[model samples]
Target: MSPPVTAPAGRKKTLSHPKKANNMPRQPRTFKAFIVLCAIALSSPFTTPATQNAQAQQNRAVQNQMQNDPDTGSKKGWWSGLPREKKMLYTTTASAAAIAVWGLATWDYGSSSGFHTAHEGAFEENAKYGGADKMGHYFATYAISDMLTGLYKSYGYDTRKANNYGVLSAWAVQAFMEIGDATSESQGFSWEDTMMNTLGALTSILMARYPALDDKIDLRVEYIANVRIGGIFDDYSNQFYSIVLKLDGFDFIKNNFLKYLELSAGYYTRGYDTDEVKKRRSVFAGVSFNLSRFFYQKHYNKTGKVLEYLQLPYTVLKGSRDLD
Candidate 1:
């Protein structure tokens, strides 16, 4: 046995943060934008004529219109539904949601006063820069739209029309926030944020319109638990260090067994709130499970449905690594 065969110590290879090497000038939310662009490219050709498609799917039984039908496909009056008390309850609940979003937009945030920064081309600097914040925007927009769709569906709206109203409600809140940020003395509305939000909302819409494709993929996010709440709004480190998954892309067996498994690659940023730690942008890869997949009978329904709004756990503990 060659005992103690210790070689002379040479220069040790130090592990460094990845952001230093690939520090390209990214426009706020650049990675999400790239992801959205790729989704769009793979979705379908952009040449479909909207008017023609609309006419092709026009209501076939418009001649036998019912009195209880909604006035328009996308909106309804406060008193349009049955049971006045239920309608009022729905109205109140919906209004509360809107008000909550308003409060968030108007929050002072207590940061350096660079408010109302809607100057031309100013978004280049303020647009979250594809950091953890972009993941929040994406997750929220997708989640909210799905919730609204369910709310509208409960009120007896058609699937297409309900989805439209849901998208509208989600975008309305997002738009309000963006406008507020634009006018903020401390912050400017960021095109980067806008891009991610739009992509998220559009994802819900696309999923709603295409049930087949929605069955094949699942979009989900997870947060690492940390002590700092970082106020009621933004948590750049723990909350923002989101694990986003575009799951179940590889079902090699074509059976439902592999249908719930997924692959994930995500961005992580260190020390955004501090000046002390060297801000090293890192990337990670991992595998996660759609818990619902194990109990297929329960979640057999596809996306764009109300029940899909529940943030199901990526239950399985699996492997992950920071990319070099």
Candidate 2:
């Protein structure tokens, strides 16, 4: 018989729709660079001396107004400022755009394979150290909720109520992302991931609402690098997680020099899904600066405040044990 014909090289041929596989449902490799660029761009507007003075003056004016007006001091009510109609319109438009963007990004974009689905519960088992990627989701949601909590507080919302708003906002974003994941052929929706996200967000909101826990504890993430073929956040392997407890939160150390110190406990896992190295988990106990209680006046120190929230660049000391 004559030789059977085959599709030409360097091209994909299909009569029906192409299978939406091979495109990983994860952040782009350039994500870190993208975040750095975004930070620089966002802060550039306040760089010039004139702009600085203007901003400082504006902050002072707002502070003065808040100080003077008993009703408008600090935060406004949930119903304050923008009209509800405009808020709804903006929200609807943003949600639509987000869905569209997700579709474009995930429907096997730039993938080398076709769409394929797995048997139920097939991908869920032994899903790489309990889907450590879920930690990424948790941290992301927590950070967003924390930011929104601060913003809502700055806008003068009642503290507890503002925290609720932050939680809801984080939950909404998580829902959108999770829905996208559920639809992807290359990946399945993970309940573990969702629960971790809730746990992360709850910590942020609860701290915002109670204030006492905020005074005592700090949840922080540290990363190095992770590389797995099908891993979420595969580019970074050592995403160390930590919770710091301020000694000053207790009366015994509140008046002593120890007030400036904090004790942190952290966990990290490495080498998952790799044949060259064994999967390892590490437990960490460390010390970090407890600068949250530090007071500043006469300046709107946005940069310092942000730095205080982050562990800062290169200033942590730790001891660890590998739990093989």
- The candidate scoring highest on TM-score is 2
Off by over 4 Å in 2: 1-81, 84-96, 99-103, 106-126, 129-131, 154-156, 225-234, 254-256, 273-275, 291-300
Q: Name the best candidate (by lDDT).
A: 2
Using Cα atoms with residue i matched to residue i, what is each candidate's TM-score against the true structure?
A: 0.56, 0.65
Over 31-146, each residue of candidate 1 has an lDDT whose tens digit, in order, gives 23223322322331111122224433443444134335655533545465365346534643564465345434533322224443332221122222224566556655665565
* Residue 237 Cα positional deviation in candidate 1, in Å, after optimal superposition: 1.8
Query: What TM-score would candidate 1 get against the native?
Result: 0.56
Show model 1 residue runs off by greater than 4 Å.
1-106, 109-115, 118-130, 227-234, 239-256, 274-276, 295-324
- lDDT at 39, model 2: 50
